[model samples]
Structures are given as C-alpha cells and as structure tokens.
Target: MDLNLRNAVITNVTGNTQDQLQDTIVDAIHSGEEKMLPGLGVLFEVIWQNADEQEKQEMLDTLENGLKKQ
Candidate 1:
C-alpha cells in the first residue's frame, strides 16, 4: 500500500471556502488529536508555498513568539 498523506490532506480540503477551512483548522487544533497534525502540516505547506517573503517572515515571527510562551 502506497499512501501519501500530504496529497490526501490537500485533496480533502481542495475546494473548501475560507470559513470552512477556518472551521476545519480551528476544530483540528481544539481537538488536539495526533492524527490532525499531518493535515495541518499540509495546509501550512500550501500556505507557505503561496506566501510572499514578508508573509513568511511574519509567520516565522508569530511562530517564534508562540514557542517562546511554551
């Protein structure tokens, strides 16, 4: 069996509206299930690929600030 999680995740959210996607993300985060991490990573991948340098830097800054709180 050849399973590609990234592809599956992408396919699952392909045409979702902004609200739908936001709900999915919020739910996955609130659920705190290990299974949802891969999907989140895939979503982040898509976001990273499309982001401008400044956007990426902003995300990094936010991530850094978040980790600092941990």
Candidate 2:
C-alpha cells in the first residue's frame, strides 16, 4: 500500500477512544480468525512493521491456527 493510504487507515482506526480502539481491535481479530483475507492482511502488515522476530513468529503461528479455523 502507498504511504498515504496506509496513513489514512491508521489515522481512521486510531482516531477512536481507548475503549473503542479495544473493541475495534477485538472485532478485527475475530475477523482475522474467520480468515477475512483483507482484514488479516492489514493486521499482519501492521504487526510486521512493529513486531520483533520472535513476536512475528508468534503472530504467524497464531495466523496459521486462525486460517485453519477458517
């Protein structure tokens, strides 16, 4: 994704209050669990940017399980 579009998405999601952010993230995780590809891809991208190698591996493992559940 282009930087501008990525920034727009981050801005939109993070604009919520802390509680709302938590709710939104929870909803997103459930969406990811269902293998909603676009949602999962967006999350994976964000996690990729911020996660360390070990964290990345953990996330990938979670994602693998999530995909299986789907």
Candidate 3:
C-alpha cells in the first residue's frame, strides 16, 4: 500500500465511531509474529494510527487476499 492510500484509509476510519480501534490495532501488531510485506507495513501503520469497523474490514480483506497469494 502507498502512503497516500494508507492515509486515505486512516482518514476514512477516523470518520467512524469505534473508540477502541487503537488498542485493537496494537493487539493485532503484537499478535502477528511473522514479518509483513514492506508495502503492507504502510497499511498496518495506517490501521494502528486510525481504524474503525469498515476500514478494518477492508484492511483485513486486503491482507487476507494478499496472504492467499502466497
């Protein structure tokens, strides 16, 4: 993911009402032990910074699709 896209996603999430998005992101980071793709790191950072239900779902779908390719 590009930084611009990541920012857009975060901005979208910030528009939502979820309050524990940050903690959930932190937990996800801590739980994942494998290394993430370089571009994907931008996505993770975006999720960590700001993520709500819709954004999270989109991010997760992107991630799952990426992993499925491997």
User: Which candidate number would show the highest TM-score if scored against the true structure?
Assistant: 1
Give per-residue CA lDDT, model 2, range 1-70, as digits (tens). Answer: 5577666657777656879866766787776565445543565588699999999899889989999999
Off by over 4 Å in 3: 1-46
What RMSD value applies to candidate 3?
Answer: 13.0
Enumerate residue pairs that collide in model 3: none
Q: How many backbone clashes can be found in candidate 3? A: 0
User: For model 1, how does the per-residue alpha-carbon lDDT over 1-70 read when each residue is reduced to its tens digit?
Assistant: 1248878888889999999999999999999999888888889989999999999999999999999999
Query: In candidate 1, which residue pairs get closer than 3 Å at backbone N, Cα or C atoms, i.e. clash?
Result: none
Name the 10 consecutive residues with the lowest summed lDDT in model 2: 35-44
Residue-level lDDT of model 3, residues 1-70, one tens digit each, is 4667667555655655455565545655776754434324664675556887888888789889999999
Cα-based RMSD of candidate 2: 4.2
lDDT of each: 0.91, 0.71, 0.62
**TM-score: the better of candidates 1 and 3:** 1
* 34 Cα displacement, candidate 1 (Å): 0.5
Off by over 4 Å in 2: 14-18, 27-43
Order of quality (TM-score): 1, 2, 3
